[model samples]
Target: MLLALYAALGVVALPRLLSQVAWFERAPRLAIAMWQAACASVVVSALLAALAVAVPASVLGHGLADFFEACATLLSHGVPFTSASARIALLLAGVLVVRITYCAACVLLSARRERRRHAEMLAIVGRHDSRLGAMVVDYDECMAYCLPGRHGLPVITTGALRTLTSAQTAAVLAHEHAHLRGRHHLVLAAVRTLVRAFSGAPLFARASSEIARLVELLADDVAARGHPRVHIAAALVGLATGRVPDFALGAGGETALVRVRRLLDPVEPLRQRERLVGILTIGVLLAGPAAVAAMPGVRAFLAHYCESFIF
Candidate 1:
């Protein structure tokens, strides 16, 4: 029942609710964590629910030991599932497995190809900037972003260097550095993979966009540590029209205007109590599916213990 509710919420409620929440813009890190937790919880709960429905409660209630024995027996004896529910569950699980595997492969191959292409471009046209710890490109478009790899090179355009003030440039560098350090591109890639897998699912589509925005906000926050918020905002404005590479984490994107406004008119960080609540919520989101999945095993263990004591 809990799993059902989770699935429904993931499909129906979460996409709308998360997108409408304005406070998340102010608490980007917490928001990122929550989005990730939500995605993970949905997938895990769906898989667990399928397994729960496929395997008889009677067998599961006897604990992990009994559950495995039953599986072994079925495999050895070539017994077919008797219940219609079990057959449906098995079909759903198989479909999910194939979808997840294909999506993962697509994401990996795409990322690898893009990275190689960008790395080759960098080697050909990029110059080392020892002062800024980045690779300077001679493009006229104002741009600053990071190309993630083993060394994670920061790529800055000549136009950006010419346009931005010294402080603004520093802020942009810090922002890109934050993306590299946090490995935010990987997060975006995962969410994107899910979106690609479930193109029709609003939750995946919304999550992909939200997570992308949140990561930029997070990078902005990190950049704020060393530079004035105004400088970061200015840098964002200057680079707002710049085009980023497909595989790069850029200082500007679709949300550049909103981010500039956020930097200029900053909201107070979440209160400690609020942050604590958010953390607890994330914990519950992750742990709830696991608990539901394990309940039968837990019950079986306790029942066995009681029976042994009586014997």
Candidate 2:
């Protein structure tokens, strides 16, 4: 019986398990880590339950009646619902729900609220031009940030505007344009969701930050691809790692280190690893659920009872 449960869990959780390890060992970024951890939590919890139960399958044959009989007999010893295994699952699910809820609140409060805040602040610093883009200077000791919405947020500071050459200004504009064009802020919000979703899991925070950095890299590429380096360089120096107001556009923020490094020396490549290792990790993770699913009795239980447990 224990074997049957473990096997079933392994099958059901296999895909998620493999994905967790694959993402963790590979990019080790935030979104990937969150997913890996969340999935890993459920699968690992099940594995531990299986270990505790130590059930012995009473019947094994091609016959359906035998499968049902054995399952019934083994479970009658101690139904899984009241077992320690079920308790682990219950705890994990509760924690995950809280984590996801907190994450959503953070994003809604952080990036989403910033949009409204900017709308009010913009009237004082910059005017809206549907075609030319909006500009502002925010002195709030925050790093310069540009987020996209119905209209583009293009922030230029009194200091930055005063310091940079027109060429630099254009370069800065190009960089922010990249952010607005690519919807980088929304991507960051999504990454944040991934980050908080797996708050208790290892490497999840690093992965989320990496994803943010990657988006910045992507934006930098768009801004600098066809322009003179000096302009963007000047812009980065002007932005210089301060917190631009939440309501304004700035050339840099969380990704400042990577951007500076790339600007200084541009040959860095994305990390690559042995595909086989990633594949195996993915295989192990994926096996978690599929293994569970493959057991007919477990599947029946899930379909009839446990499905309700899934949020």
Candidate 3:
């Protein structure tokens, strides 16, 4: 039952609620953390629920010793699943593991391929820019973005160099630098992997889009530390129509217009108390499902020890 609730929340409730939350737009880092916690909680809760169903209460009642024995039985001849529910749970667990692993591999491999291709392109057509501390690609498009890897390089186009003022260019570079510094691409890649693996799942799709947007907002925040918000907004406008490689984090994209508006009309930063509350909320969202999932084992442990003491 707990597992079902978690699955429902992950697949339906949380995604819908989060999509509608305007506060998340104001506090993007907190929002990112919440999304991550929510995703992890759902996965963990689902696995625990599967285990709970597969291993009978009789086995769990005997505590850790019997738990390991049951695991060994499962590995050897497989446990005699007396109930259809047990068989279904075991099957679900297997499917989850395989799905997650395959999706992760796909994401990694695809990223590597993209990076390799981009690197080759950069080697041929890209020039080093000491002033900007980035690679200058001699393209006509007004673009600025960063390709992330061991040899991660920020790239700006000749067109962008002509289009943006010195301050605007600085702001754009700062934004891309933040992306590279924070390793934001990995966060995006992970969510995207889940989406690819579960193409039918609206939750993963929503998560992918939301996380991507939040990371952009986060990068904007970082850039704002070093450059005027107005300059950054201007840079966003200058680069709004520019194109970057699919794998790269660009200064302008679908969120650019909204980001520009945000920069121009910035909201006050969250108060310390509000930040604390947000942190606590993330903690509860992550821990609640886990605690609920562990209850059966905890209860069984207490019951077994109490029975022993009584005897």
Give the number of the best model, judged by lDDT. Answer: 1
Ranking by TM-score: 3, 1, 2
Off by over 4 Å in 1: 72-78, 241-254
**lDDT minimum window of 10 residues, candidate 2:** 52-61
Candidate ranking (lDDT, best to worst): 1, 3, 2
Q: State the lDDT of candidate 2 residue by residue for 1-311, as single tens digits.
A: 44345544544554344444433322323334344443444435454444334332222213457666755875687555546664665565456567777887888677767787876677676655444364665444423456468765876655665666667777777878888987777656765675666564333454455556566666666777767765677678766634344565454453565566566666433345544555455565556554543465454545654455674
Go through the candidates in order and give the C-alpha RMSD of each one to the true structure.
Answer: 3.5, 9.9, 3.4
Better lDDT candidate (1, 3): 1
Tell me the whole-model lDDT of each prediction, alpha carbons only. Answer: 0.85, 0.56, 0.84
Which candidate number would show the highest TM-score if scored against the true structure? 3
Tens-place lDDT digits, model 1, residues 1-311 = 57867876786677787777667988999999988888888888988888888886667777668889999998899798898888899889889889988998899788978998998989898899999899999998787879997778789999889888888899999999999999998899888888888788778888888899899999999999999999999888777644453556554455877898889998899889888988998998899998998887678778877988999
Compute the lDDT of residue 271 as modeled in candidate 2.
Answer: 45
Clashes of each: 0, 46, 0
Model 2 score (lDDT): 0.56
CA shift of 88, model 3, Å: 2.5
CA error at residue 310 for candidate 1, angstroms: 2.9
